[model samples]
Target: MAFFRQLVGKILKNFNDRLSVSAAAALAFAVFCVLKAKGKPKFPFVNLSNFMLVLQKKLVEEVIFDGSHILFRCVNQAQWHVTQAEPMIRGKELFKSLVQYRCQFK
Candidate 1:
């Protein structure tokens, strides 16, 4: 029990550090937005399908599938990592959706 508590504390500390870094980056981005609001060129609008297509091409460099979760590594030198928990639904719909998206994109 003591070991588990220490492990969880370390994990939370690491997560908090990462969150602070992300917050700083987000602040910098907001500064850029404020500057760009002054007579800057408008960015092109992207719809969900187009955004999904772009993500399909560049977002996931590798996928590590575990029993009930997935880890996705982006193509940016392992800088961006995402983990998603599997949805609880009848008939393995999450797996089916992934296959269907793969086929559709192909």
Candidate 2:
């Protein structure tokens, strides 16, 4: 009887330890998600209509003039600077600009 009681106590203690570790991990993940979400900007300017307008403006500019290396350098610097913004829209904007500007020269 004593041997069975000891085995049950050991099992219960291990299960409690696992549950505590799991709870701690879950809490950490939730905190990380909240912080990451908080860093995102709720910008209304990321709609499809505005995106099309930006594309049209770029196309017009490209048609009117040849590409400049200075423009490329400035854009690269801008990308490096703005990469710190954790917002998805900012990331998309940076990617779009890099592709449009670099592709024109290449």
lDDT of 1 by residue, 13-43 (tens): 6555866666655655675676578664433
**What TM-score, computed on C-alpha atoms, does each candidate reach?**
0.33, 0.26
Candidate 2 residues lying further than 4 Å off, grouped into runs, are 1-16, 42-54, 57-106
**1-106, model 2: which lDDT tens digit per residue?**
5864674465556555866666655655675687678795432223433333444445323211122111111211322111222333344556558557644662
What C-alpha lDDT, on a 0 to 100 scale, does residue 71 get in candidate 1?
A: 44
Q: How much is 79 displaced in model 2, in angstroms?
A: 15
Q: Which ten residues in a row have the lowest lDDT in candidate 1?
A: 81-90
What local distance difference test score does each model get? Answer: 0.52, 0.42
